[model samples]
Target: MSGFNNRNHAVLLPERLARFGPVEPGAKVKVRIPTEHRSLPFDQAIWPEEAAVLRTVSRHLPNVPKVLATRRGFSVQTFAEGTELAAIWGSKPNVKGGVVEGLASLFAALARIPVDELPKPPAGWPAFGDSTGFIHCLIDYTRTRVEAPAHARYGPLFGALGFPADALRRFSDGLPRDGLTPRPFVLLHADLHPRNLIYNEEDGSLHAIDWELAMVGDPVHDLAIHLCRTEYPNRGERQRFISAWHRAVRAANLPAVADYRRDLPWYVGYQRVRSVYTDVIRSVELLGPAPTGEELDARAAAVCRVLARAWAPVGLPGSPSLGGVRAALRDWAAERSEPGPPLADLRARLRRRLAEARTAFSGYFAGAPAPLPPDGPPASASRMRAR
Candidate 1:
C-alpha cells in the first residue's frame, strides 16, 4: 500500500512497473492524481475535471474502461491495461498505410467531441486566442523567455537557423484577420503526447490518459500539435498523418468549417513553436541545480536547434517539396553535432522516449471505423470572446 497525500491518491502496482519493462500491459496498478492544489493553486480542480471527462468519454467511447472506482480527488478506472506506445517507437517497422489511417481516425474521434460539453480552464486562466494569437504566444515565449539562455549560449547557431528575436510577432503583425480565424471550437487534450496514449495488446485499442490541460478549443489545435510533434522532420510520415486526419474528419461526420488541408501548414507551424517553448521550459526544470557551464551551454544549443527546426516549413499539404525538409533537417543536425556531458545524453534519451511512444502508437488503428461525417452542418468560422 502507498500513502495518500495533499494531491495524489497513491495506488501501488501489482508488480513493479519498471521491472515489467518500464511499462507493461494487464498488470493491475494503482495511480494517484491530485485532489488539491499541492503542485499549483489550480491543481485541485484538474482532478475533478479529469473525472468528468473520463465519464463522458467512457459513456461515448466503446473501448474505454468504464469508471471502476472513485474518491474525492481521484478515481480508478480499469486500466486499459495496454503497452505504452512510447516504449517501442524507434524499432517499429513502417507499416504501409497505417500511420495516416490511425491519425485520421484519431482526429475524427476528436472532432466528434461536442465543444460546449467539455471542461473549461478556471476563471482566469490564460485564454488561447485564435490560432494566430496562439502562434504569437509560442514565438514570444521561445524567443523572449524560453530560449533566452540558449540564444546567449549559441548565438551563432540561432542566426544560422534564421530564428531572429520577435520572428513570430513580426509575422503575426503582418497577417490578415482571416489568418487568425478559429476553427469550430471543440474539446482538446492540450497535452496529447505519447505517454498519455496506451495501446491494448489484446485488441490494439488505443486509450488516451492524462487530461491535465484538456479544455474546449479549436479541434485543430490538438490535431496540429500531435502531428507536428510526431511527424516534425519526417516528410513522408507527416503527409501520411495529415491524410489520415482528413479521412477521419470526413468519416466522423463532424462539421467541416473550411478546408483543413489548406490551413494545416500554418497550424503545423503554430504547434511547432508552441512545442519548442514547452520543451525548453521542461528541459531547464529537469536539469535542476546549476550544473557546469558546459552542461548549460549544451542545453541552450538544443533549445535553439529545436526552434530553428520548428520554424522550417514542413512544406504545404499536397505540395510537399520532396527533399527540401529532409535536407534542412540533415543540415541542422550536422551543424549542431557536438559532444557534451550527461545533460546532452539526457535530452537525447528523452527525445528517444518520445520516438518510442510514437512507434507504440502505430499499432492502435487496426479497427478504426471509416471516417464519420460532421455531426451536423459545419458551424460558421466566427470568433468567440476569450472567456
Candidate 2:
C-alpha cells in the first residue's frame, strides 16, 4: 500500500502475521509510524507512550488492534479486518437506531476501564486521579502549546487582520466553568470520528484505531470532541447519538455520563477555538513560497472561513475580510521561501496546469463568479483514517 504524510508519518503494509514471530500465522499486519510535528503541539509525546497505551487498552477492549511489535518511531499491529465506517457511510453516517446504539456501547466500554489499571501517563501530566484539574490543565495546554506559539508566529498578521493576540486567552477565561459537574476522568480516545472507526459488516462490530491522542480526561470532553469531529449531518442526528451515549454510559453505571448535556457545549466551543490556531498554521504552511495569485486566494478563503466560524466562539471583535486575509497571506508568503521536494515540485506542476485550464474555461463562460467557500467551516480535527 502507498504511504502518505500528514500531522504524522504513516504507511499501510500487508505482511503475514508470522513475520512478527507470534500467533496467527497467515494474518496480515498493519504498520503504523507515528511522527510528531513540532508545529502541532497539542498531542503529548507519541511513539512509545502511545504504543504502550495501545497494548494496555487492547487487553480489555477486543476491538482495539493488537500490538504485534514495537520500536522507536514505528509499530506493527494485527490489521483490523473490516471496512472503515467513513467509507461505508460516505462522510456522514446516519445515526438513527442501531448505529447509535453500537457507538454508545463502545463509549460505555471505554469509560468502564478503571483508571488505576491504565499505564501511568507520560511525565509532567497533572497528577493522576484529578479530573477537574486535568480539564483545567487541558485548557492551559491549549493556551501554551497551541495559542501562544501560534500567536508568536502569526501575531502581527492576525492582529493586523483584527484578531488580537489575547483572543484565545480571553476566550478560555470566559468559558463558563461554574456549572460544570465534577465527573471522574476516564481513558479517552480523544479522536474518535468515523475515519478512525472500522466496522465489521459480518458481525456488526466497530473497532477503534489511532490511539495517539488518547488521554485521561473528562469523559464529557471526550464525547464533545467526538461529536464535533464526526460532523453529523444535522442537529437531530447529533442529539440522537448523544442520547444513545448517555443511556449506554448510564446503563454501565458511569457517573460522568450524567454531566455530558450540561458540559458538552463548553467543550465544543473549546474545540472550535483550538481549531482556529491549528487551521491558521496549516493554511500558512500550505502556502509554501511563490504561490500563484489563485493559490493565495484559495488558501486565504480557507483561512478566512475558519476565522469566521471561530470568531463567535472566541468573542473576537471582528474577522478579517477575504481581501484582508489575501493581503496578509501575500505578505507572509513573501517572507518565507522554503523549497519542497521533487514530488511536491511535480504536484505543483500538475496543479498549475489544472488551474490554467480552469481559468480558460471560466473565461469562455464570460468569467462567471467563482463559487464561494462551503456553508460552514471544515472539521477542526484530523480526519485521516488509520491505515
Candidate 3:
C-alpha cells in the first residue's frame, strides 16, 4: 500500500503486480495484473504458468502469498503484511545475522519443493536438472530474444555500436565448459533481489513475493543471481552469506551445493553479460525522440561502464571512446530525422534522404557507419556548434 497510487482509475502496484484496492475500512485483498510485455523473454514465456506454480508452492511454503483467485492476466492474492527488506537493509553496509539466516532458510525451503509436484516448464525449456545446458539455452535466448529483437527494433542506432549480429553467439562460445557437471535441479526463486523480499520485524520472518520469474534450475545458479543482484556491503559479507547458504542447502541435502565454488563464477558472468544486452537496449530507448548532447554523453558513459565490466566475460571489443559514442549517437539521430517545415528541418530532411539513397540497396545496412570519426569534436564542442 505504501507505493500504491490511484491513477486513471487504476491502482499502481510494484513490479508487475498491477492495480488493486480502494482502501475501505479493512480491505485485505490485492490484485496482480500481468503486464503485456516482459523485459526478458524467459519471463514472457513462463509468466502465464506462475499462478499455478505459486498456488502449488504456497501449499508447501507458508511465506508465499496465498492466491485467492486467478484469471488470465489477473489474479487476486492475500495482501502480504510486512516492511520490504529493501527499505530496511538495501542501503546498509551489513545486515543482522538473523536476517541472513532467515533468507537462507527461505531459500532452502524453496529448494526442498518436490520437482515432480510443480507444473511442466514452458516450451523449449532445457532438460530437467541440466545446469550447464540451461545456461547454454539462456545464451541462445540472449541472442534470439534479447539481441536479435532489439537489433530489429533499433537497427540503425545499435548498428552504430559496431557489434555484429552474431556478437552474443561469439560471447557464449567464449565461456569455459570444462567443469560444468549436471546436478539435480530444484525449485528456485529466480529473481531474489532485496525488493522482492518482505521482512516482518516482529516475527522475524521473510516472505518472498513475485513468482513471475520463478523456475526449476540448478540451485547454485539461484544463489549466484541473488548475490549479484543484492549487492552485499563487501566481499566479507558476501562470503559470510555464501557460507550460510551452503549450510542451509547442504542440510536440505541439495547436491548443487557441492559445486557452488566451481559453478558460481560462470553463473555470475552469465548474469553480467545478460545485463549488458538489456541495459544497452534500455539506454538507447531512454534517448527518446530528441536528446540533448549532455544526455547522450551520460547515456554513453553509463553503457560504457557496463560494457567495460562485461568485455572480458562476454569477449567484447573495447568500448567506444566517449567522443566516438557521442558522434555515433548524433549521426544516428540525424539519420532518423524526417523533413520539417523550417529551413533547419529541410537540411535534416535532405541529409536523411541522401543517406537513404546511399544505403537504399543495402536494405538497412548500406554504408557501414564507423564509430565517431577520431577528429570529431568533444561533447562540449558539439553542444557549442549546435547552439
Instruction: List the global CA lDDT of all models.
Output: 0.47, 0.65, 0.63
Error of 3 at 329 (Å): 4.8
> TM-scores of all models?
0.58, 0.77, 0.74
Model 1: per-residue lDDT, tens digit, 1-387? 111121121233323232423234443433333321111121122324466776666556554444444444444445556665554444454522443365456657766866555666455433543555454544454455445655565455445444554545544554456765555555666555454566665555577766555665556667766765452346776676666676677667444435566665666675555455444434443343434556555555666555555555422123222233233333434454442334444334433433343343223212211111334111111111000
Kindly list the per-residue Cα lDDT of model 2 for residues 1-387, writing each as its tens digit: 211221211223323335554445545555553322425685543234667788778877888877765544445566677887777654435432556688888888888888777777666676544555665677777888777887777777677566657666676677666645667777889888877788887778888988877888678877877876776767888888888889888877567776667678778777777777766776776566678998898878777877787788777675559998888888887874443233344344433433443353332222211221333222222232221
Question: Each model's number of backbone clashes?
Answer: 22, 0, 0
lDDT of 1: 0.47
Across 89-193, the per-residue lDDT of candidate 3 in tens digits comes to 855444457889988888888778898898888687878877778888767767777778767766766667655566667767766656466777888888887
Q: How close is candidate 2 to the true structure, as a TM-score?
A: 0.77
Output the TM-score of candidate 3: 0.74
> How far in Å is the alpha carbon of 29 misplaced in model 3?
2.0
